[model samples]
Target: MMITMKQNSRAPNAITSLDVYLNSLKVGVIVRTPGDFSAFSLNESYRQTGGHPVLSLSLRAASGGLRKDPKPVSKTVPAFFANLLPEDKLREAMEKHHAEAVRPGNDFDLLAALGADLPGAIRVVPSEGSLAVQPVREEGKGKARFSLAGVQMKLSVMKNTGKGGGLTLPLDDNDGQYIAKFPSTAFPGVSENEFANLALAEAISMEVPERELVEKSDFAGIPEDFDTMSDGKVLLIRRFDRDEGHSRIHIEDMAQVFGIYPARKYDGAAYHDIASALNVAISPSAALEFVRRLTLAVITGNGDMHLKNWSLIYRGDGNTPALSPVYDLLSTVPYIPADGMALSLGGERSFKALTADRWKAFAHRARMPEPAVLRAVTDTVALVNENWWQLPERAHVPDRVLDRIDAHIKTLTPILTSCANS
Candidate 1:
């Protein structure tokens, strides 16, 4: 049975939180997104939905599609879950109360329910028009790995190093090489939108990593070359963590590098701090350039820009560092509920509070030369104002949100002009 929700009923509203469930045994983890994209676990675990989250889901995997259920079913999966009580305590609980802790839902099902018949560069569809999606199976190596699109990739359990989720892997094939990021649950779809914006960045000649999107699938449980509903659902991109010849580079989130470990303290680490930290020779004038880029992001309504969303990748050769591509990019003001930008602009915490002068001042502090700043800001305006909205023929974005963005851009013109002329 392929289940469907109301077309716009369950749409994500500025996805705010993500929860990660790490299997006690190994790197096997499951990311659970609550509230906006709320749903429950399909697996058998005492700690199911209500149990406390063991890990966090990476923001990179944007979304997945649903396939028809080829098999029979138990009752509908629960819509919510509770954290597991301490094992010692659960044993003492009265028998009748156990099931009460994990209430099942009658209507709610898998969050991703759309079936897809997406195309790829390498292969044609099998004789079967579409494929069904099954719950992830536990087999060979006891790993929770799956494939996507026509690509064969594996998901191994990750051990959390102090900095972030640690189950890092390579997304390499004959085409190009990239790193896959797996974050604990609660991450907004930062990585997913970043993949979409990378194409826009490249169009404007922004230096970035070579990457592409991959569909999700299963290996053992899924027949070889079978169609999958989850295929073409997630946005997979190349990781700048590694470069040519497969050498890993030194990379750290600004949070850890700046010593602001908690999620709430990320804003304290400014763009200038990150810019100044870079080795100058290879990334000549990168600090100033980044400031200009940041201004462009603000005016363009890429409200989701945040500390974890930004990165600096050092070439394995110890060359100068460069801003990782403009990833996790989106006009979240329209899609999300925060009603403002993720990382503040010019010290203003909210997007509605940002002004053109403040944007310029921020760029100046970043040490971007006036000319370069002007060019980056002006160039981005030209690229986006002329395109982006038209890029997607049938996207989930609302028209009103797009219109609001246009008005915001209009308001920014005078400020951008002052900088350009100065």
Candidate 2:
């Protein structure tokens, strides 16, 4: 089952082109050089129809123009393209299952493996005259091609047959509408932890996707390790990037927009950097939303809000995109006490050291109104203080975990209150 580089009939080493589809429409083509460098060009018809640009500001311009590159715009492959592939444990699973070794930084192989069902409306397929991109399919299903980027041990699965039913794993199918995250063996009840965290965010009136905690019995034929405990529960997060009809909607992460690799998601950047990028790539509302989410992350003890965790969803009206609904919201402090904030906030990774002055400085750097920034922080802190405890109570989080989080929240309350009062 070894997968070798596909050769085109025209030339052995001829450039390989993959048709990039936005839902059913072919919007562009990503070309791969003999040296394995990838570059994208918008389709002429899509350009004429004034379709939205696929890549973000760093690789593609607002006017539907790709960055000028004597070589490819990106040295290996575009960060946007690279960010779509599976990473860490999931990647190892993909390679083992497909029997194809994904080369380091080789986006071509990664896309060929799971290009059919990506995060957004964009789908990559081999163009005519290029080597055909074949996906490993199940017997009755067309192609079971899907990949979710991240280090987390999770799987994409279809929703329950009816309301209040259980979710089914789509291991042999590609039409999944939800992402199921298992409880980590290393951290007991992590599924419940994330569910409660997301529920808390929703209670605070934050834009978060619908989620549920389903019992392991709901799913059939899943691996034993996936259901770590005898009574383990799975957190099912509905895909927000999909439309009402379950069609793919375009979305890109902050790492892709900032032209940074996923490996460097937590390094060499700060909250202000993402806010500034949002201002330039999206609208004022989106930038403001970014500020609010950042505040929420700080107070909720979510130290894993890295670049890949924040994303922009394309509205299909043009190049303009909006901030996506919050996903992967969880308190990491309880599990890893030594863990700091994923990205520095106002040049401070320590949650305790964050002050009003630092927030104002971040606002200045992001070109946002200072008063509005302060209000967002104050509002978020107030909401968390008022309703945070209700989340654990409602979700029935373990008493031990609840006590630890409550203690952590207490320490954070005075700091946030002082910042708001200032």
The lDDT for every candidate, in the order shown, is 0.38, 0.71
Q: Assess candidate 1 and give its lDDT.
A: 0.38
**Candidate 1 structure quality by residue, lDDT tens digits, 189-251:** 333444545655666567766654443431122222222223233344554543454333434
Model 1 CA deviation exceeding 4 Å by range: 1-139, 144-195, 217-232, 278-284, 367-375, 387-418
User: How well does candidate 2 score on lDDT at residue 350?
Assistant: 79
lDDT (Cα, 0-100) at 149 in candidate 2: 84
Worst 10 residues of 1 by lDDT: 117-126
lDDT, model 2:
0.71
Question: Per-residue alpha-carbon lDDT of model 2 for 1-422, expressed as tens digits?
Answer: 21123465222123267777766677677788765667777777766654445545565656756654324754455667778888887766665554433444456766765666788776766676343333333455332357788978777778666666666666522567888887777777678778888888888887889888887677764543233443577888889877778767788888887788778999957889989888877777778888878887777677999989998888765367888889988878788775668997777887887679878888888889888888888888888888886555445676666666777778877776666776
How many residue pairs clash per model?
Answer: 33, 0
Worst 10 residues of 2 by lDDT: 3-12
Q: Could you report the Cα RMSD, in angstroms, for every candidate shown?
A: 17.8, 4.8
After TM-score superposition, what is the CA distance of residue 380 in candidate 2 from its true location, in Å? 1.0
